[model samples]
Target: MTDTEIRAGIAEVARAHLGYEGELLDDTSLVEALRLDSVRLLTLVAELENHFRVVLEDGDEAGIEHVADLVAVLRRRIG
Candidate 1:
């Protein structure tokens, strides 16, 4: 998938997981914007893996801060 498509997929998974009713911006901070706790983080990771069929790197788990980070990570893995 292209980067835009990857980001869109990530946003869809995030919105579904968080029950968010609005758009997820590129710069939205995951922790501050979504208040993602460990369980929710795990769910997001699992869903991303299932949705993308790509395994996340350990660095991704630790480094993701904004919605864009997911795009960067997946772009590297799948692009």
Candidate 2:
């Protein structure tokens, strides 16, 4: 799928699982923008994995700080 589709899926997962409704830009900090606690963050990750049908590495979350980073990771995994 395209990056735009991945990004849209992320937004949908965030909204459905985390109650996040704001716009997610490339530079948008996941922590700051989503106000995510550890549990919520994990939930988001799990939902993203399920939504995208990709198993993210344990280290994947470590490198993700912004929406773009998550999109990049998913793009790589999806490919």
Candidate 3:
């Protein structure tokens, strides 16, 4: 899938699962913007994996500080 599609899926998942209704820009901070705690982050990751049908390895989320980071990770996994 393209980056835009991944991003849209992310937005949809965030809205549907996390109750986040704000804009999700590439530079949007995961911590500051989404306020993702460990559990919430994990939930998002799991949902993303399910949505994209990819298994994200342990520690794959290590340096994901922004939306772009997550998108990049998903793009790599999906590719």
Candidate 4:
């Protein structure tokens, strides 16, 4: 999938899991902006992995501090 599609998927997951309706900026912190706890974040990860058919490493998310960071990880995996 393309970056746009990956981002859209993330946004869709955020909408479904976090009740987020606004645009997700690059700088949007997943914890702060989306209010995602560990469980919700894992749920999002699972959904992304299933949709993209990629096995996301635990380390892949270590440095993911923002929505853009998450998109970058997905981009690498999907590409």
lDDT of 2 at 71: 94
Report every candidate's CA lDDT: 0.79, 0.90, 0.90, 0.83
The predicted structure with the larger TM-score, 2 or 4, is 2
The reply for model 3, stretches above 4 Å from the true place, is none
- Screening candidate 2 with a backbone cut-off below 3 angstroms (N, C-alpha, C), the clashing residue pairs are none
Give the alpha carbon lDDT tens digit for every residue of 1-79 in model 4.
Answer: 7777888988887787668898887888888877778787778788778777899986898889988899999999887
User: For residues 2-79, could you state the per-residue lDDT of candidate 1 as single tens digits?
Assistant: 877987888788778767556667787877766789988888888888889988877776677888876888888775
Q: Tens digits of per-residue lDDT for model 2 on 1-79? A: 9888989999999999888899999889999988889898889888988999999987877778999999999999999
lDDT score at residue 1, model 4, on the 0-100 scale: 73
lDDT of candidate 1 at residue 62, scale 0 to 100:
64
Name the runs in model 1 displaced over 4 angstroms.
Answer: none
Among residues 3 or more apart in sequence or in different chains, the pairs in candidate 1 whose N, CA or C atoms overlap within 3 Å are none
Q: Judging by TM-score, tell me the better candidate of 1 and 3.
A: 3
> What lDDT tens digits, residue by residue, belong to model 3 across residues 1-79?
8999999999999998899999999999988876788899889988998899999998888898899999999999998
- Report the Cα lDDT for residue 14, model 2: 91
